[model samples]
Target: MTNGFCSDDFAPVKEAFDRNFKELGEVGASVCLTVDGDTKVDLWGGIADPKTGDLWEEDTASIVFSCTKAATALCAHILIDRGALDPAQRVAHYWPEFAKNGKENTTVQMMLNHESAVPAFRDPVRPGGFLDWDYMVARIEDEDAWWEPGTRNGYHMVNFGWTVGELVRRVSGRSLGQFFADEVAGPTGADFWIGVPDNFAKPLAPILPYAAKPGDELSEFSATLLAEPQSLQALSFLNHGGWNMNDPAAHRAEIGGAGGIANARGQVAWYTALATNDGRLVSPEYLATMTRVSVATSRDATLLVPSRFASGFMKSMDNRAHRQGNQASAIIGDSAFGHVGAGGSIGFADPECGLAFSYTMNQMGQGILLNERGQSLIDAAYKVLGFANNRSGAWCR
Candidate 1:
């Protein structure tokens, strides 16, 4: 049974949340939805640790992987809104070291929108070395541009934390984590963290990796990508010092693009702030720049599929974001924007509907984007919002 409140208007959302555990093999998860600044549904259930049989408590939080990127982007946007940083300025204007190796022309907007062509490291990064921020920044500084600046676009993956994060640090005179906490999380009272602190660390749930069954067969697309050790797809993910969600050292470090630890409540709250144009956080004009489609295409050099992105956020464009035969953007309403974690966790805001929703889980799913587990919950949410018949499946717009 789910363990949180669900208002009468969102009863259908609770039904779908329960179905995730019964039918989708959900180990533990939470779904939170806030509309017009008030929470409509907040629920969490199942075992947080199967080994110890620990219940997933109301306070439990976990690593939301790429979902962290949206929060990181917010830090930059906050600076932009404050007139402390300019998006069109070259990144080299803030960090001269970045000007080397044909990247002198790369703009802050290009980096924010994933069009800067910064992907993987030329030299192999050591395991756990991702915790060393200075070393990682040095590596990024010396690396050559993977593609001509602003010409081709690829997901920055592990590099985004340093590429854009360092720029935030230089311009703001604060680490990305400090800037986010001081400006976004603290002011808004959201339980999200780019760098997990000592007090919050205990509530962090460990992630369990998904393993394919013996009968599963790799798609030709998947087989070919894995077969090449040097493919851009392979390099972008594998080149990172291997990731371990439970590593305390890693959690304590602020890897802005990913490595964010948060719960469904925190995720929903952050987006609600965005949806309402909480002027204290983001101005409406700049928020438009954030939500507008900055890049839209079918094939990402790193992801090998159609991907849509705004400035530091994912746009719900087409089915190219599908995962495990499910529309990853299924929950996406027209013009709605948010980011999903590496696993099934998702968080997005629909301005037109004044809706902010988030789903987070410890059980990793095979889907690269939205899994069946997340999609089902999304479908139910939109149904209650009176958009059940929307063509985008779960979209409310």
Candidate 2:
């Protein structure tokens, strides 16, 4: 088929795909774009299989790492809009046991902002720790926090999905994954899926090998923002038995932060719905709240950097790599928000432009976290919208 994007308009996008596939050893990759709520770019190339070199198809779903957190948080925001859960309410109100260990005062907003200090399980996290939903919650219930909740923002690490999911379950009486499907994915008909189901495993492309070597370039980025010098190498996100793509039973696993899997279509749809106020998933008012920066400026205990949190979502306190653009990636617009997966995959929306952009890839870059390829596409989008290199450190609401 002819390239969906105009040749001139798609130059940077095509370049990004080609450079990654060739120079960066990218195996399978896909990118999607919706402008003014219309799909302007839906393109995939490169091989999905390393063994036989099978090409990436239109329906390839890869595990979109932290990008899943946004979807999970979206579930919570849905209920918040419906008045089922209050961000400011004490978490104990929803799940009484959560009040143990001086946590009675912790609010749902605190947990979502990564301010709850439940980064790791405070216990060993193994494969099925994901399955033992109750044990996981119990652990959080009994343990003292690493820091005071709501004092600062930190990456929830492995515990974000569980913490948020548990609160969601108590409020909605459905597992995090189920609530997401019933309230978010199913209604939107987007390709994004959390807690992978058995039947859908066939279409997924397992994560390609990357994080093994630091190759010297990313050492600074690794040390500064990641809280560890060898973070990129020690980052074992791809280690789950089938972290690549999960089967049915695995779909219910509480990976609110990581287990989200999606093709380009799903990512685009999420932003499409988010931008246009497509009902049944998340309302426009709630969507606005999701990016409201619930936590203010401070050094995060886990991420060890300054950040702003919007309930269970993340916003930029400063211009970081993913926040790359004229104004800053995170500060693109008041309504611009989405999340990036661990590897090179990224998805987000800018309602101001009526645009949603996504890029998925198998090859993981050695950069600290954000991939240059994905950022390039976003920069091009900014150029198309006439805000190519903003530095005002402000977002137009």
Using TM-score as the measure, the top candidate is 1
**Counted clashes in each candidate structure:** 1, 9
Poorest 10 consecutive residues by lDDT, candidate 1: 320-329
lDDT per residue as tens, model 2, 1-397 = 1123434565666666567666766678788888777776787877776776667777877777778888888888888899999988999899888786766678988888887766654344456555567766777787677667777666776567778888889899998888888887776778787776656544667676565554444333345434643332223232233332434454546577777878777888877887666565666665667656667664556544455666766553344533222122333455567766665567777767787778887676653345566666666666666664645443432
Q: Residue 385 in model 2: shift from native, Å?
A: 1.8
Best by lDDT: 1
Q: Measured by TM-score, how close is model 1 to the native structure?
A: 0.95
TM-score of each: 0.95, 0.85
Please report, in order, the local distance difference test score of every candidate based on alpha carbons: 0.82, 0.67
Q: Give the C-alpha miss distance for residue 1 in model 1, angstroms.
A: 2.7
Instruction: Return the clash pairs for model 1, or none.
Output: 298-306
